[model samples]
Target chain A: MADFSYYIFCAMLLGGALVVLLSRGYVNAAMGMLCSMLGAAGLMVLMQCYFLAFVMVSVYAGSVLVLFVFVVMLIGDVKENSSIWRKIGIVGLWVVLGAFVGWVSPMLSQAAAGLSKTTEVVFLSQAKNYGLVLMTEFMLPFQIAGALLLAAMIGVMVVAKNPSRKKARRELV
Target chain B: MSYLINQTATCMPALLGTADCSYADMALFIVLKVVFALAAIIVIMCFAALSVVAERKVCAYIQGRYGPNRTAIPIIAAIPLVGNFLKKNGLMQLVADGLKFLLKEDPLPAHVSKLWYLAAPIMSLSPILICACLIPFGVWWDSGGAAHPLAAANIDVSLLAVLAIGALGVYGAIMAGWSSNSKFPYMGAIRASAQVISYELTMALAAMSVVLYMGSVSDSPLSLFEIASAQEQSWFFMTQPLAALLFIVALFAETNRLPFDMAESETDLVSGFHTEYGSFKFGLFFVGEYGHVALGSALFIILFLGAWNPLPYISYPESWGWISTLLGFITFLVKISAMIFFFIWVRWTLPRFRYDQVMALCWKCLMPLALANLVFYMAIAAI
Candidate 1:
């Protein structure tokens, strides 16, 4: 049953990616991205990472992809130019990407299984366990990441500050 | 893995065993889960429908008018004293409203995006209903001393599941706005998305504060039932009132209720994202809003108010757990209903905020307060 679900989610992920790449309209592409992200989240659930799965959905599908859809709407509609050569190129790209994924997937699954075995604790992916590991084992790196985000947020504020208002103040001075 | 499997399997009553479970068990479990889920949804739908009537009645009482009281069935009104009483009290208003919605022609404006316009209402309504499944409405212990939650889905991280799924409802509002291709709804959708995204941060932070407190108190994981049980002696609202306050405010915005209803402010955006929506589609959005209010209030009770927990300093004895569980369930329902009434009261009493003020309140006021509350609690817990 789990294997069947894996196939369905993989199809959703791959199909959604295909739609994102090949769809002509910006809104369509955004919707495709949403589908792909949801598929990825479902895959995370299958992998027994429930917290990460919901985080993927809440952060990506909920926030980031919503912003993406809104941005696409704000930009108005984009026209698709469909040509034979573009279709052929996309098909070729799919073949290469499929081959790469097929070659790498087994190795990735093996590594995931090995990690689970090494831990000797299946519920380590639970939120409390994750928090324990994060706060204790990776506290420094986590703080650094937080600091980096804070710096980036400050940069955004500086960049987006009203330049016209600044110029007006300078002129008055 | 077996522990995790059992936790999930409890949600499916048919598959209550381990690897030795038969196919029959699995099939029965799936059927039972579906039936339970359907029952829960129906109960929510009824609540949503009745809440409309309740809201109107409350709003009218607040403004000194009779709202929807005259919408009685003629035949029922023909009856003696009881009929007149029912008619005057607006008891049949829910039925009348449902009939009206069903009978109305669903108008699709020629200018709208056909696909998304049709899909928007479904999108808006579904996530809230799905999130309802994860909420623990009551707690009952089996004869074997195993505690069971009266909920649909019983996974850990129930809090995050609810938040994440609830967040997806924003797309429905956005889709309604953009797909409508109308100016008012477009503005409404933009406001809706921005408002939701901003408040969600504060809401998450506030919830995390509770989660952090729970973690410190019980060393239990971030499950709703666990959190509620830890508050048996003292509700989180008493200790962490600030977080509860922030969460309530954020919930108002999330449900698009008045005072923070920039998305569908009738005065400004002409019904907001639902400006172009009418008939049953509009009904879905309406019901979805109420469902959010219902579920949001339930979550608040669970997180802060001590779900199914009796009064402060009062403990339910384990010797006769069933009676205590029943009392707790009743208490939980009463708390949730009171919260819903408060939602209506606040909606009518307060004035709506300007879109800019809404954003500013979330980012400038609530966000900072939540962060400070979280840090303060963290320090206290550490000490």
Candidate 2:
């Protein structure tokens, strides 16, 4: 039953991604991405990472996708007509991706089968364990990520600010 | 994963099967969970329906008029004092309104996007139902004196689950507005998405403070059941008043209640996201809104009002068994009703905030306040 559910989630993830790739409408694409995120969260739950799963749903599917749709709605629906060459290129890319996956499948399956034999797998079931690891073991990396985010936010703020308007106000004053 | 499965299996072995838990028992467990989920959804839907009646009655009382007192079926209207009381309280209006929604023609506007227009109401309601399973409404004490939460799912990260699931409700509004293919709905959807996104930060931060406080006091701080149980001595509202205040304010915004109802402000947005939606679809949205309100109230009760506990510092007697459980459930129901009443009262009393004002309040005021509250709680925990 568990394996059946896992396969279902996998199908959902791949199907959603396919929908995202193929859908023409922006809202449809966003919804597809939401489905993909939910599938990924389900997989995380199967892996016993409940905290990570919920975070993925809340942050990515919930907030980020909402923002994506918000932007899409604000921009309005614009149908883009791609050249035939571009379509051919996408088909070629899909073939190459499928071939690559086919080539890697056996090794991936072998690794996954080996993983089942491992008795001791590190599991962060509780939220505290995640906090402990972030604070102690991964403190520097976490801090660096935070700093990077802050820097990006500052950059966006600077870019968004109307510098000419500020200068004009200063001159007027 | 095995641990989670085993934990669930052990939690309710009596309901599942024999003492020896097996694979088939897990299937039974899933069925039991589904039944519980359905029950929770029914309870929530009923509350939502009744709250509509309560809202009308409350609004009438506030405005000095009788609301829906005349709407009643003949059979029900023929009763003596009971019928008059029911009519006076506008209880039968619920039945009439429900029948209207059911019997009315569900119209699909020509201009609207067919798929999303149909999907939006279901999307709006499912998240609330999912979150409802996480709430520990009351505690059931067994013969051995051990207490089990009267909830559908007792997951460890229930608080996070609730927040995450609840946030997805924005999609419903967004979809409804966008699919409507009308300017009013589009504007309402935009406002809703922006408002939800803005207020979500404050809501998370405020809830985080409560989580932090619970962490210091309890074993499993992230679990809703544990959080409720931790408040056996005093509710979080007393200890973390600022956080509670921020949470309540954010809750109002999140649920799109009056004073923060930028989504469906009837004055400007022409009923907002559900502008093009009529009949049953509109009814679904209506019920979904109230469901969100009801669940939000239940969440507030669990977080700040001490869940099933009758009052602060007063714990239910473990020795009383089923009677204690009954009392706890009653207490929980009463608390939820009071919280719902408070929601309705505020809706009737307060005027809607301007769009820009709502945005400014969320980002400029509530966010900073929530952040400070979290920091203060962190400092207290550290000390």
Model 1 residue B347 distance off true place after TM-score fit, in angstroms: 0.9
Cα lDDT tens digits for candidate 1, B1-383: 23333534653332322234567656666676677678667756766776888898999999999887677788988899988887877888878888888899999999998998999999999998888778877777776677777777777888898899999999999989988989999988988888898899999999998887777656445788888878778888998999999999999999999999988999878799999999999998999999889888888989888888778767576667778777777788788778889999999999988888988888889999999998998898788
Candidate 1's C-alpha lDDT?
Answer: 0.84
| Residue lDDT tens for model 2, B1-383 | 23334557674543323244556766667777788888888878888988999999889999999788887778877899998888888898898888899899888889888999999999998899898888887887655556678888888899999999999998999999999999999999999999999999999999999899878766668899988888889898998898889999999999999999999999998899999988888888999999999999988888888999998999888888778888998899888889989999999999999999999998889998998888888998899
The clash count for each model shown is 1, 0
Candidate 2 residues A13-81, lDDT tens each? 877876677677878888988988999999898777899999999999889888899899888976666
Candidate 2: which stretches are off by over 4 Å? A83-119, B1-7, B10-24
Off by over 4 Å in 1: A109-121, A136-148, B1-20, B74-85
Per-chain TM-score of chain B, candidate 1?
A: 0.92
List chain A TM-scores, every candidate, in order: 0.85, 0.80
Clashing pairs in 2: none
